[model samples]
Target: MKYANNIAAIDELSASEGVFTTAQAQRLGISRNALSHACKVGRLERVAHGAYRLSGAPSSETDELAAIWKLTASTAFSWERQAKWDGVAVGGSTAAWLLGIGDFHLSPYRIYAPERINSKIESARFGVRNVDEGDMAWMGGLPVTRAERTLADLCLDCEDPSLVEGAFRDAAAQGLIDSTKLGSLLDELGESKRRAALLEPLARALSASDQKGQS
Candidate 1:
């Protein structure tokens, strides 16, 4: 409850965002009652059931995001596991990052899990959606659309076309996806005139890269 004690606990929790339950507080030489009292007095704030945050640390946002992801994955209501069960992948943007295709900067952290996974769970947690028909593939124990699928997803969802272009260019340059595959995906999507137009140039760029490799 004391200022110094609260500060020390903040440092400990910052190092590891495990919930500082009453039992853990006892080991820190602080009574459970004292910990509860500190929380009551505004020295700490409970973000989740037992997860506490210091009033001064604004960096809790990232920790909270990570915690939400873990919590969602652990629950029976999770779409992530369902995606696995349905033989769908959980990648695209998230997979692209794993594949070293591009930087992970797109919004909502796109996930390409199975179409059967609960849309509610996806919307509630990571804002996930189905992988477009063309670019679906498996990677790293999860089903994900290919790099081209990832680029197309970004193009559809991103507000900034330039950002999508940048990711497409980076993936193309790295040879992370196939040009013909990307084109096939675009044609399969069949509804997004804007997206098809945007991707056309990037797909050509990838084609050029492939031709250069053959030569």
Candidate 2:
């Protein structure tokens, strides 16, 4: 089953935004030998120990995040490790920018890494914070915090809520996350009352977008 250029194989590879793992290749009916052959001849480029990228794929900042998924979540590992790390997701203001939701891009992109192994990010600006319930989702092929989660996490990391309100509004207006989900999450906030401010701007932005849409 060496369909290296098979449309389905290519689609599967591209879905990870050009990043894939050995397990992913196997599922795509690409044998390990086929994988080695592809890399040997230049169709794929090996990344790190167990990741590969389609040769000539366009570069992207999300590439780093995608690489994380390939190496961590997608790698072959014990069942316990998979279950434990399933909640890991890229979070904080950097996540907003990564999801095209806001302009709150900061160096050392933050990730909610509860327990990481061999996870040395090359960028100095990349930061890791310990958090529970790191729910994740796909954002244009990158593993990222859910839209609502991203906003909530940003609020915790923000110094001035006013500064990031516009970004929150933009995200809400774009309908990137569900209001109900956000409400539920907010309700769970133990002492972080400041996050409540996000709701107002989100409502206003969604309202404005709705009115504009109708008019």
Candidate 3:
């Protein structure tokens, strides 16, 4: 019964996804000593500092998200504790997808942090950057850049304007981005005209949408 309970404890610590952290074991009513013993017995695998995986858990890209959740935020895996997850925000192409405003799938998952994090990861490539946190929000249980911030950053720093424009259209059509908020963000960022120019096509589409609604 005790061993069965330990298994149940491990299941809870992993959030049923089979990934957890050393710090989380204690919080889950399992001692660090027990975790170490589990590791020795091949029940757990240390994936990185304070991060672990069930020995035969299904593999997926989300495992990296689990590791990051450990590093940036507290180990508590409840919605109530998510308030403390201000340390990281998903960014770049990854944010575009997570925000539900783009279809493009690019490599090297990107995350914006208050500061750069040097860490090892498996199953995904990570591009962590210390960047401005103007438009930070949560999507699909992950802290990620808001649509306006994601599109603006793409327009400002990325080499491909066409891709950025497509993402802009998708976000605007879905009402995922607020033009007024985007404008204000650009004003604060400076070079407002230049950046706004990048979104001209989206503006035209919105104008057309407005006219159709009126008609």
What lDDT would candidate 1 get against the real structure? Answer: 0.54
Clashes of each: 3, 2, 0
Per-residue lDDT of candidate 3, residues 64-102 (tens digit): 665665555546663644555555666777778776666
Sort by TM-score, top down from the best: 3, 2, 1
Residue ranges of candidate 3 with Cα displaced over 4 Å:
1-5, 16-18, 29-50, 53-61, 74-81, 120-134, 191-215
Candidate 1 C-alpha lDDT tens digits along 155-179: 5555345555666778767777677
TM-score of 2: 0.58
Q: What would the per-residue lDDT of candidate 2 be over residues 146-203, giving only the tens digit for each residue?
A: 7777766766665345645666677767777676666666566524455555444544
Screening candidate 3 with a backbone cut-off below 3 angstroms (N, C-alpha, C), the clashing residue pairs are: none
Q: For residue 71, what is the lDDT in candidate 1?
A: 39
Q: What's the best-to-worst order under lDDT? A: 3, 2, 1
- Against the hidden reference, what TM-scores do the models get? 0.47, 0.58, 0.67
Best-matching candidate per TM-score:
3
Output the worst ten-in-a-row residue range by lDDT, candidate 3.
123-132
